[model samples]
Target chain A: MRPFEYASPNSKEQVAALLGTSWEQGAILAGGTDLLALMKDDVVTPRRLVNVKGIDTLRGTSYQPGNGLRIGALTTIAELADSKDLAQYPMLFEAVTEAASPQIRNLATIGGNMCQRPRCWYFRSGMGLMPMTKDGKSLVVAGDNRYAAILGTQTGAYFVSPSTIAPALIAYGAKVRIYSAKASGSGVRELPLGRFFITPKSAKEREHDLKPDEMVIELIVPPPPQNLKTGYFEVRQKAAFDWPLAMAAVALQMDGNTVKSARVVMGHVAPVPWVSDEAAATLVGKTITPDTAMAAANAAVTKAKPLSMNKYKITLAKAAVKRAVLKAGGAA
Target chain B: MADDRPRKPEDNSGVTRRDFMKVSAVGVAVPVVLGSVMDAAAEEVPIQGPGKVPITLQVNGKKLSAQLEPRVTLLDALRDNFDLTGAKRVCDRGACGACTVLMDGKPVYACAILAIDAQGRMITTIEALAEGDSLSPVMQAFVAHDAQQCGFCTPGFIVTTTNFLQKQPAPTAEEIRHGLSGNFCRCGTYDGIRAVALAHAGGKQS
Candidate 1:
């Protein structure tokens, strides 16, 4: 690891000022679970790091009955997983618990998990942040793409979204608060969390849509309909301390025994949290029986164009969808 | 936030080398800090390198300070600078969890945390766990169950188990597996380790 200047800033304004031009100049250090690994691997060499863990405002999870939940950016994954009140939003609980191992969750922040880089070997190894061929060919097109994105990569650069928290949060209608002086006076803006991801069109692009000078201050989940039932399911290569092969989160709004509306999001299979409109369409106005779940599962993977080695992911993704739907519908 | 106010140089118990050299003119033996200030008679303070910075850390129960580059990991500082090498660094990344230690009572990867960033928090390395000739309870359990083969991953697993079993004294089978999932042994001693954790936590006796 390279030497860098370290500062424990008290306010978000000071942190934003220290962040420098890009991720390489000065990086934000929340929990250091992911950032240290990147530095150890020589993937990113930031000359300075601003530690925000000491900021008092960036720690807590508060809830209001008619309003929503406000999750501070520095809230640890273990703290989030241990909150019993989050049982109402079971998708979040499931996703938070399924991430990494227990030791990692003790140090990994929810915001860092949402903004982490990909697990693509090409990205981690020094090929590039977004691996590509010199002649504009897709390296993952015919290579070992077992964990590559099956959706949202028709052109090039197939890499799975590494976030375990974003899909569930997006299904729960979450918004992220970005704080920065670069935007304007006392700059602050709330963007829907679903719009936070940026897929690679060319090799020079980074993953998230965040500006270099801005930092995610908090995440807000809006109040949900009382009849909504949510579930999150992930299929991993190993049972512990490994990234998932495919995962799905479902939030179904029920009217009696029938579905009024639905939000189904599939992750680890796309460049971003892939919202499955077809699966949602199949669930609305229909009973959530195993038959409907199967139909939705089939519809969810309609756009999955698997790479040469990742054809198995399609079946795994479909199974995750079916399981998520059944679990959300209270049948499983 | 009261912490936002900067501290004056006179109010501090510690100072940079340049400040220490100026103070050395009045009192010959100023105070015995973690490092030797006897060389201050040179009449000049050496300029620190770009990445090098002096940091004071209260490691274990003692305040042991060192001059280290900002990139030095807590694991490296413990093994190299402090000469406490109980925590092994197998996979330098967080995946293997070979360098787990108690940070503010929670097990974290020591290798993944920078030494400079760990100043204000309480850090407990594996060297602080034992007393005299006897091993800790978690260590005894590992030995009793014959849970170790390579022993490279023993410190991390034992530290994690000691912290975990103290919180969950009566762990079920699933809880034992889930609690220790962070540490992995390439030698495949999980079954023995799980049995030891359960027995030591009073599961067998209960």
Candidate 2:
């Protein structure tokens, strides 16, 4: 780790100022679970580290009935997993718990997890193994792409977004509050989780629409629908601290025994949280029987473009989606 | 009671002409010396530069303050500067809980936390588990059960078990497993560890 100046700012304004100063010089230090690893791996070398934990306003979990839950940016994953409010939002709790081991969760912040970099081995290893083009060639077209990506291939970067909470939040209809340095007042933009992600082809920018200097101050999850049932399911090799191979977050608005509306999102298969409105639309006005659930899951994966080694991910993703939908629908 | 005696400057040996010639030769090799000094300085640079960041931390029953960098991990600050080595460092990554410490009464991986982030929290480490020369009841139970083999992971287990006991002194076997799962024992002392935890939880100890 290179020597860097340290600052423990007391307010979000100070934090934004530090970040707005220069991207090349400063990096925000939240939980340090991911940032420290990146620093150790030499992936990012910032000249100054601005610690945000000292800010009193960036730390708690609040809930209001008929309104929503507002989680501070510095709230730890362990806190979220053990939150009482999360009992009303089981999908959020389950996603937070399934993210990493207890030790990792103890120190990983929710904001940091949402804004973490991709878990591409090539990116971490700094080997330039990602499909880069001298003129226009997909280098990862033939290499080890077992965990690359099954969607968003045209833009050439095939890395999975390793955030478990993002999919669940998206499924629950959460919005982010971003704070910028230059702005007189912080800007609050509310977008459904489905619209939060943009592929490289769709928008050649980064995963989330957060600017370089803006910080995610808090996440607000609107009150769930009266008849909505939500659940999250992830498939992994072992209980080891690796990202999920395939995951699904399902939220269904059921009318009696029939589904009225549904939100089914697949994770780790695309560059961002892949929301399947097509699959969701197929479930409305239909009974959530095994056949209906299977059809929805199959419909979700029809447009999936699997890489060579990651073809297994398509089956795994379908199974996850099916299980999550069944579980959320209370059929399992 | 003072026996005041002035020391004489004459007792010191004066510089020799040969030493002066040696110093002159070293001056001629100044570029190489300066280059090596600069290289050493670069390598010795601290990860977080020096500054007295005001942090109010309540550890155990006392409040303490220490100058630390934003990048200095809680594990490093505690072990290196504060001399509290009860928390071990096995896999510096959060994989192993050898550096588990409680913040605001909840267990957290010390190695994964930045010292600056832990400000204004009540931190409890393994060092606080003893009273005078006597070990805490949980520690005594661990010793009686022979739970520790090499003792590398003992501090983390002790701290984690202490926190768990604080929450639920009488935990079920499943709860014990879940609570201690954050820690790793390279020596496979899990059976004994479980026995110690159960014994303590069963009112055999505190």
Candidate 3:
């Protein structure tokens, strides 16, 4: 890793001020699992690092009976997986445990996981975020793209979102609380986690809707409904230390034996967590069976535009969606 | 809420020789900026360097002090400065578990952790596992089962297994497989490793 000035601040205000307004000026260091690797490869060379791990407010997970679940940004994946309070939301546990490995889970924070740089080979090789040739042809479209996005590629961003827990979080209607010292009033703002991700059009932009100085402080997941059932599933190359080939998360609000409403989201198959409204629509007002689950799964990938080497992802994605939906509905 | 703070000027000049020289020349500017921003705080925050800074780490029940840059990894600090070569740096990246060590009794990759960040935490390396002139229980199990081939991945495996057994003394078959999945053995000594880990966990050897 490159040499950089390190500032350990105890408060969010100091952190915001210490951070640079751009990637080059400074970078936030929570769990260095991702940032250190990026720095070692010279992918991101920040002049200063604001280590926010010292901030006491940005760690822990709390859930109130009538209220919701509030997860501190610095909570590690292992903590999230082991929390007894999160057992009601089994999808969160599954997603966290299904991530990298024990050692990585111990160090990697949930916030860092959400904001991690893309694992696209082209991007890692120092090609810009929207990797392109000198002639402006997309390298991903023209070259090997086995792990690239199958959905939302029309914007020229082909790299798949590297988040494993995002689909499950979004399925549960999670919202991110962002903190900025410069902001007026409370200096905190909230946004739906699903809307936080964006497909950047250029190298100057970022994959998430975060300003350089602003940091995610907390994730607010609303209380699970009495009728709600959620499931998370991932199809990966191996059981551990592997990014998902394709994954899906499903949350079903059942009316007795019938599905009253549903949310289906797929990950690693798109630039963002691909929220499948079509699949959710297909499942509403119907009882979950093998056939209905399969139909909903088929509907989930109907609009996928796979690159040459990644057509197999469509099949894997369908299987994930079907399995996740069936698991949510207690049909499998 | 509106962000009224004026945005800092962007330095799109990229990482060039000129930029490096400029950064070195103004090396003191970052701390000044940070100190100014944190003037209102109850406690003053100190900014350490792009250069070496003094840091003390509690490793293996001893407080070891070393001067290290902010960018130096725990693995490098352990192996180079402190001479604790037990944690092997195989994949430098977090993929391989050869750099595994215990931070606050939880397994973590030393390569992925910054040495400065590891301050104030208890770090246990492979060297701390055994008593004087005697192999640790985990090490003995590895030997008894012939769990090592080239032995490059043994330190990490033993460290991980020692902690894993403490956490789940009677781990199921599935748990054993999942627990050690983080560490990779290129020599394909997985069966031996599994046998010993299972045997150590008090499960009947298959």
Query: Lowest-scoring 10 consecutive residues by lDDT in candidate 3 chain B?
Result: B1-10
What does the i-RMS of model 2 come to?
A: 15.6
Q: Provide a comma-separated list of chain B TM-scores, one per candidate.
A: 0.74, 0.70, 0.79
Q: How well is candidate 2 docked (DockQ)?
A: 0.15
Candidate 2 at residue B22, lDDT? Answer: 26
Angstrom error at residue A224, model 2: 1.0
For model 2 the TM-score comes to: 0.81
Taking chain A of candidate 3, what TM-score results? Answer: 0.98
Candidate 2 Cα lDDT to native: 0.75
Q: For candidate 3, write residues A151-267 as lDDT tens digits.
A: 888889999999989999999999999988768888899999999999887767889999988999999999999899987889988877789899999999999999999999999
CAPRI grade, predicted model 1: acceptable
Candidate 2: the clashing residue pairs are: none
Per-candidate iRMSD? 10.9, 15.6, 6.1
Tens-place lDDT per residue, model 1, B1-206, is 11222333223232255433432332343454522533322223222222456766777888878877767889898888988788898998888878999989899999888888788779888878876578987788789888999899999998899898888988998788788989999999888899897797667622
In model 2, the Cα lDDT at residue B54 comes to 49
For candidate 3 chain A, which ten residues in a row score worst on lDDT? A14-23
Rank candidates by lDDT, best first. 3, 1, 2
